[model samples]
Target: MSENETQAEVGTTRRGWTASKVLIAVVLTAVVTFGMTALLVNILERRTESAQPNHNVVELSDTTYDPAVWGQNYPQQYESYLRTEEMGLTVYGGSQPIELTPSETDPRSVGSSSRLEDDPRLRIMWAGYAFAKGYTHARGHEWMLEDQRYTVRVLDFNQPGTCLNCHASMPEVYDELGNGDREAGFDTVNAMTYSEATQHASGPVACIDCHDPDTMSLRITRPAFVTGIAALKASEGIEDYDVNRDATTDEMRSYVCAQCHVEYYFDGDAGNRLTFPWAEGNHIDDIWKYYEEDGHIDFEHEITGASILKAQHPEFEIWSQGVHADAGVSCADCHMSYDRSAAQKVTDHHINSPLFDANASCGTCHSDDAETLVNRVVTLQDRFVVSRNQAFDALVSLIYNIEEGMANGVDEDSLDLAREYQNKASFYLDFVYSENSYGFHAPDYTQSVLIDSMDASRMGELALEGASREDLEASEVTQKYAQDIEDRSDLEFLR
Candidate 1:
């Protein structure tokens, strides 16, 4: 009851409060110290692990065609590589598996959606060609060989061994065919029947195709790409350019993909030799010029007896026209973006669209969030689709007009001019269509291509209406170039 007793109680409370504050501070300090220590240890471990060499359980060689064999040495990369089998859909691209009833002829019970069925216009576009028979959506790298082997394009039609050049891992086949001379093997394999050449392919693309066995550095293994790049460089005034020797590491990242992703043709004169038409350049116009000079026709259009040039996937060429390539971003930078596996950074081998992992892919350079980046990509693609549809519709209208013209007994010169226009329109439109990017790779460039395609279709329509060749011809510059090419061709023929 005394004042002293009250003061004593107050002092006891103050002491207890001070002791509680000290206890809290000590616990906080210990927690902070522990976290910092753990973080430092983690950093050190990661650094040490990254610095250490990859421990190889088995020796790989040029003969090692199995990806599983490569997996033993670089498990992280191999693991990601195997994930290529995982199929899912993105907004614009990425494969979605479609279930199929396996038949004796085609043993696969699952496949991607048919592109031909998705757009019947493609059938008309590729009429009189195997592609019109059947063309399916592209699946992962793992399915490349299997899809090629059993597709109606190969099953119902006659195909050269050259078709297998990009579909399967060719190093082993090349070795077997050419007695260790890959170029010779490439020549031999390309000349064989698809059935015979396919017999030698071990599997889809493997490590040896893109990587050196000893150093694991990127290399160009495809002879076609080697010749293609050299020709492309030569056109740029760089004579005797060897991609394997001259390309930088960053350039190789894209060049390896360019091997199979660019437009190509079979040189019948050279025994169906698989060839990339980059002798002039990789641009659509340049490619058109090259084809014009070569006079290599794929097939005669069934609807309009036009000599047509088939444009295969031209991803590399399209991408080269994009801002990403301008910024020096490689294909591997996006589709095969780098990710950490435990302690080391490795390129993700599950090659697919950047949309699936925008943060890991696009986010590497762009500061935008994943969803925003994806939406930006989709917006570009949406615009591209609108333009593409317009161009495609125009092309289809021309095809129909040409058919009608033929039925109406149009003059041969008029019909021929319209057919030539159809060839350009179809090939240009198909170039953009076949490219997997859906115009996200180079939005403006892609739009320009579509516009040109639509213009070609318009010119074809005019030709059908009996427009003069002089009026229907391309721009002054293009006309001059065409004349020069014709002049050169005549000179060469004389020689």
Candidate 2:
């Protein structure tokens, strides 16, 4: 009886069901298509952004990064850096600031006595710079931040922002602010007005010290290094940083740190840029050749301003000339040695000398009692002491003569020659003292370096004798270095 109505209702129901199925398919297809597009866009965006900067750097929120987060980001380096704070083992490189054998009392059997006691000679040579005020051999990474603060306080009261160049986690400074800090906008930190960078400065150093947070890969974040290297490269007729770039793991270790801890000079250019004179080369004689041999340097032997070549902590550079660096042992490889224990795995922050982890360090290469390796360094250190004392004698005498010459009308002409001696003597002394006999990282290299230090000191005395006092007085170059001891009596530099 209701056949027609039943047929019509069935067809309508069937049509409704077909429409619902079509809608469902369209919605599912749209969702999936959108999802794929979003994913591709994300991947492409990352690629495009990274393409602009040859190095894809990631930023770390220093204020927010936790130990776990850091471990995830940089298991090797993060853990390694943390180990820098440990206080185990010998003082190795740890700070005994309060009890550090007073410089004068330090054993003269090794170069430590020269490094500590005779630091006053540097005060005279560097009258216009901070070193004249005071400088000490570094203890470890822990002291970096502390040293920065202490140095700033002890140096010029009118010091500019350039003071932050090597100490603080300056990458954070440059990022939080712009690159207008001392390393960027400087000819002199004491020039113009002092920067207000103190408020923005962070700790001595941290993960950002040698890494780009984004990629957790090593990168040079200091502008002084970038610009300094450029000046050096340009002077040497090189164009790319790739020339000095490390291609392997070993070289990168020390080279990464050398990117900052290097000798540098400020240019008289517009920015008075902090420049590294590495263009000619990175050796003692090589850098000297560029500074003096080429006749490109400024020299005015004024009591307050001496045409100068500052020697930075060439730990890496010196290490490079040593057996460990030659063998491809990096600074990280030794200084930041790792260990696995029973319950929890821990990377130490109490980093000091590799002596603390002798097995982890020297053991990786030569298998021997650490005492044997340390003894080699001590023996070399002992042999070098004779030369160190000699160099100290020569430097002290030359500095005194430089003062007397000014009084006797001898003139400041020979001061540059005097400085060359100073530079070499310093390098030799540095290598000897920095070898960390306890670390056993580079015993052979340490031995050879002490010998070199002794030789350089003798050579310095010879150079001082050869230069004319007349020439020193006449060469009143752009920058003048102090030559008179009596005139500088009140300078408040080291005693």
Cα RMSD for candidates in order = 17.9, 19.8
What TM-score do all the candidates reach, one by one?
A: 0.85, 0.62
lDDT (Cα atoms) of all candidates against the true structure: 0.84, 0.50
How far is 354's C-alpha from truth in model 2 (Å)? 1.1
Instruction: Report lDDT (Cα) of residue 26, candidate 2.
Output: 56
Best by lDDT: 1
Best candidate per TM-score, number? 1
- Model 2: lDDT equals 0.50
Local lDDT at 34 for model 2: 68
